[model samples]
Target: MKIHINQLEEGCILAKDILSASNKVLAYKKTIVTEHIKHALKAFLVNEVHVENLLEDGRGFLPSGIQKEASNEEKEKVELTPVKTFHQLYNHAVMERKQLFTGWQSGTQIEIAKVRQIILPLISELKHQEGEILKLYQYCKKEDYLSHHSVSVALLSAFLAKRLGYDQGEINQIAITGLLCDCGMARISPVILTKKVTLTEREYLDLKQHPVHSYNLLKSIMSLKEGVKMGVLQHHERMDGSGYPLGVKGDQAHPYSKIVALADTYQAMVSERPYRSKQSPFKVLEQIMQHDFGRFELNAVNELKKAVIKFSAGTKVKLSNGLKAEIVFVDEQFPTRPIVKIEKTGDITSLKDKKELYIQEIF
Candidate 1:
């Protein structure tokens, strides 16, 4: 029976493994729970668990008066707000993307309409609740990195496009471009994709071929525009002629491709991968500002910084010094380091002057 984590009891056997938000197994199936195990689950932020061998009541250890089940209509009628709806849609997109990639690997014809079905609703929902969408970016799982990264790039691309004052039609097209930019990964081997160690030089070279592969697949779609095709083909191409496939300079690359590239890099850095833990958004932004100015188009990076600061300012955060604080202001000149108000003493600290202090996490 499924039960809340708080209801978990000693001696209860796990029916299934408990997984973290990143999809890593925390507790294995058939493991008997003990007091220490319960504490560990709480520390892992687990919300629910499945227990085997229920008592005669079938409800097991659930407190009295709690409903065991809801009516079909009641369950089906649960209203989802824009953000909640986006989560459901994102999960659907990930599963569908997996199937779509498998079909592509089998040489099946790629369908542009199916891609639209996955991206259009997300774009529409983002127009209403962009902040919620930004907040959800941090929840992307490491295990399903490909699909989650695709969705995240699409969202960030659309957000950046809007910030750049792109028209509605342009925004939708950019979002779709972001969604399929990495579809070429379907042609790569799963072992290379999920390697826990650093890839060798040859493996990295083969991995870089994905952009060209993606372009070849996307070029066959008659419905895709020239700009969209180029975006997928050159999303990895850098402004300084340092990217793969074409090595095109800033003037040589398409503007849409540059936007997607910026979004892609940001999403990849902030996401947890098999090889490395996730970095804080502030750290990623700081790195981009300090080192990536010449590699990415200036306007695209600036717009991304603006979008990030707009949503991230005023959020409660943990400081590097181990103090809890709430951001009070964001300086346009230094977007990464904002003014924060300490939670304990009501002291205002400006991160700009205090270079030693940094934000550790968003609470």
Candidate 2:
């Protein structure tokens, strides 16, 4: 039965998962209503709740005169408006980046005030709790992907910084730096930026210089911290001297830049693009850990690996081969590929041996 917030009482059990606009879980189903939860539901303007017929205290949830259940149409009407969730903050940041990117295309200088406005809320949300960076693909749109990529890179970079135990002040600087790392891309021609076909040699060379362009654009902003400016400039530099622009290797690249680079690379792989569909998260992680050794800092990549694919025994997951299974073991060296027991046949399979299969998703 769905009831109004005014009718909510302690001990009423949630019958369905309460989700935010972004489809993020707010309150899981079967959670018993508590005072704090009631207040949160009200603050988020959740007008209705689909609760079990009986309360936790063994009382009827609905009064005798009240409607026992709402129709499917009514259920659809019970949309939750989490105005202050990360979803809202993230969407606004994406639009803010879109507008800023457009302004940059026309020779507008980087506005530190507007930039802070975009970064602060996001940083605050990050401080509030650790978010699932793997789920950021839900917000990416191929048509406006540049804006999406900017915000996601910033978030992933910031997440890596925090996981690395950086202080809040350092984390804030890294977050802003990550967002502006691609600011140089604005200087590139739109024709080149959005080209669907292969780029000519000249165009490819020009695109590779974006980090230098980004550095020049940020160097003029006096209020920005020194490291923030440097991070944007060196984001593309690889640890093994394989990267472009200055081609600085090892410590020549700033530490913050390495975090941004790691996040930037990961986001690009998982996000959908016009030329190719997005790959599985496990697949991306597997490739990153297996193939991209020495290209990215081990500490940053390891932290991301631990956070994204935290393996535990008995965890239910769907396999790439379209079979359901329970994880039975996790090899620390290759966490992305774990040993699992097939659900139907009760047979064990080692993912490292079967190179073709990987985890599709966790249920």
lDDT of 2 by residue, 1-363 (tens): 888877777667788988643455667776666656777677565678888866555554655554444434433434444456777778889998999999999999999778877876677676555644666776788888889999999888888898899998898889998899999999999998888778899999999899989989989788999899989988988999998777899998899999999888888888887666676567788888879888999999899888765634577878988999998888887788888999999999999899888887665
TM-score of each: 0.74, 0.73
What is candidate 2's local distance difference test score? 0.81
- Ten residues in a row with the worst lDDT in model 1? 74-83
Error of model 1, residue 305, in angstroms: 1.7
lDDT of 1 by residue, 22-68 (tens): 45566777666666667777665567889986786443443355344
RMSD of 2: 9.6
- Candidate 2 lands at a TM-score of 0.73
Model 1 residue 257 lDDT score: 93
* Candidate 2: worst-modelled 10 consecutive residues by lDDT: 70-79
